[model samples]
Target: MVSSVLQWSIFMSIFSSICCLRRDYFITAEEHWWDYAPSKQNLITNDRTISDRLIQTTEYRIGSVYKKVKLKQFTDGSFRREIKPAPWMGYVGPTIKGETGDVLYVHFRNLASRPYGLHPHGVQYFKDSEGSLYMDGTSGRDKLDDTVPPGYTYTYRWSMLNTFAPTKDDENCVPVGYHPHVRSTKDIDTGVVGILLICKPGTLNPDNSRKDVDREFVLYADTVNETNSWLIDQSLNLCLNPQRCRQLFNQKNEAFITDTLMYSINGYIYGNLPDFPVYEGEKVAFYAMGLNLGLHVFGVQGQSFTFKRKRTHAVVFGIAWFQGLYMTTRNPGRWMIFCKVNYHFNRELYYRLSGMNTHCYSYCYNN
Candidate 1:
């Protein structure tokens, strides 16, 4: 009996270990041309008349220019050569998914013209995987992973430690971000950022789809400085007028830069964002991350969501931060999800709501 029990115990231990095995993801940082605003007709309008006559147009010429930048992404493993859509529409990197107690093996390849590295937030890693160049106690190869030069590759192993798991009051899935740490500000501004989703055990399927929610949306709010467009060769050539690039850059035109600064959601400005689809009763999770400077307040008109049983209409003061919201698709209609800041609201930071039926079942308050 003792020998039989020992064999069973060992078998159970092996099965548990297999169940806790980590997952691997291969991501590459490649430069790609991205059209920041794809809409031919701008949705922004000014009611003021010019000399008592109406002067209306649908184009914000400078803000709608295209640019090339490095983005972190994964390929679909296709054998035939085909043009792939920018990963996550070129706004952010593909969502890296894992669960509590799982390990994430990210093999990063830098295919851009300059050096960049992947640094993750809210994960466990040794000095070699930290992805930032600095004088730490470590020496030798430990510093090599910090800055991945162009044409090089680095593998970073990060463990989703239990400490970052969801608490009792928190949602089943937690959100984290990964971005280039080499020349942090410049790299981030040049479009090297992505999302990481760490879920509770059993909350995510083996394919990384969330079992608890019917749909998920990741929204990144950022202010893109168009003045930096000249830094990339493709953007300079794609300028509305090639000579305009020289004029803007050589003259150090501040007014033109300020006017062209785009307040964008997911690399889309104005009403260029696609409509989010959802069923009437399904659960929806909205994950938001604010990038760069300035205070950003996100609000959804004609709808309200509950956080901790407190009704809130908007994500207030979500400046250079990350937050998530879970809401039932109760009140569905053509709602407006927009930034409430005066500058952003009046500019091009709004998206239309569609494919939702109106059904208000819970109490909600307005902002």
Candidate 2:
């Protein structure tokens, strides 16, 4: 009788462990209209004038203008379908969560017109679930899951093995990005990017929320080339009118394109970036990455951060990669976090504060 009871207990434990080892995510690829800048103002310099700024600086185009493009993004199965919605609501994809030793079963449905696939980084997938197409010398059934056509669905199985797990020094959450490989450049440039976050085992609560973190912010600093933007001509015509676009493109196409390059933080320019709210003394983590081109300098006025165990005022010379900072909100006040790069600063790659009461308005003018 004692031996039988022990065996039953062991079996129950094993079954519970197996149940915790699997995480399934339902993701859908759909087309939606994303507003790069919603606040119809110069977020960089707070300039209210529109005519002169719009003509000279491509960074100032505001309002319900700009042509609507079919940007491919990942949405949760229950996410509502909308045209131009906030970034958090399926514009930049859902924040994927998983744990070490867990298997991620992603049911991906492609609703876009083009063929696309979900290729993830820092994870393990078999050849049939690679979600990428290349000359990898594989044939027959091995490459069947490379790209999923429009109106088709494919299930990608990814394993977060211990080999690819986060290191001890890594924060509770780590970021992973996924995009389509069919037309890599155009797809990413036209906004096919989404974020995936993997957490350490037992770091997430029963409700799938991060533990011991009050607030988390992920910033993708990117320079979007207007010429390569999806529906560039249509966007220009809608924003600046047909005759004006013709004149501008004819005389100074290169300059116009250069000026139109959107230096944005999470697709928001000027001060259109949303405010980050947090209470005093809460733990905060900022995950930053630079996409596309140019150097990104992330700075938060009135606060010092700890990056890699060193104290720094800002993350200087942030390249096109991932960099993280963990800090405690000891100093209470509304602060400004902006990119220190000259062009990015001038283009309004920053976010304003609404809460807290730290008096350091000097940093705003220094930019």
Candidate 3:
């Protein structure tokens, strides 16, 4: 029998190289100070009264602190150990997991001050790990990952091929995003970005998690545009009248760029995102990305989800794209997830989806 079919193809190629794996992360590209209202109070108007229009600081509204440049993660590669995410993951990044035949190895490093790198989108890499730049001609070390200045270091190396798996009708896990393509919209408006996922075969857990999900969130949605921040001139010196924020930023006016553009998520706003526990029946998921800078509609207020296969209650995307919503929590209590448009639902995000509602709310609750 052809020697037992070549010994069962060498025992399924040594059991697919002992159940594939690689994973390493250790990212970086720092720079601090964020605070999109760290309870500088206003849980839907519990109010701290600076005439709370969602934490107003006036003079030209630089209100919610700034000066970003994120993409941190590090727990190794001696980038000192830091893994603290969850203040509703604002300033994004961190969450680069894998599984589809696994293999990642990021290891970036650029301690921020300018130049950046680390691309990612799905998987499989080439062109020296394409970290985005134009002229793909291939010179020197294949263009040192496009641009990784400031106290440098770079690695990239992705792999997850099986055509990047997941599609028996999808959903065994599958996200996609990563940023700082050097000048990619000023390095994602100076906040870098992240979220990768992957998964499938046997559906993870050797600590890759998701043995069928039990709470996971990522909700991106952007439009942060803090005037193309690179610390927009040191955040116009934390404005309170940095010459009327350089005269309404040289009159970019549209009501002062609609009170300093920030209709966010994973970057907080209004409700100041921070409160996530979710109990009742569990299962949960919620990946839902964006950044093509247009529509949003993502929703939730008590429950009803499944998206893409449709059981919907809201899932309209845009902001580059990527979606995966799923729910199982059978109504808990303090809900609210948000972005149903209507001016994104409230603190005036450029008002008028028939009179704004600006909701950046986030609250899952259990305690």
Candidate 2: clashing pairs of residues: 43-270, 43-271, 333-356, 333-357, 333-358
Q: What TM-score, over all chains together, does every model reach?
A: 0.81, 0.78, 0.37
**Which lDDT tens digits does candidate 3 get at residues 173-255?**
88888886767877787788888988787777776668898778888877777777777778767777888877778778676
Best by the TM-score measure: 1
Sort by TM-score, best first: what order?
1, 2, 3
Model 1, 83-138: lDDT tens per residue?
34332234677778888877778878777888889889888776777898666766
RMSD of 2: 8.1
lDDT of each: 0.67, 0.63, 0.72
Q: Which residue segments of model 1 deviate by more than 4 Å?
A: 1-19, 44-63, 70-72, 75-90, 240-244, 357-367
lDDT value, candidate 1, whole model: 0.67
Worst 10 residues of 2 by lDDT: 55-64
Which should have the higher TM-score, number 2 or number 3? 2
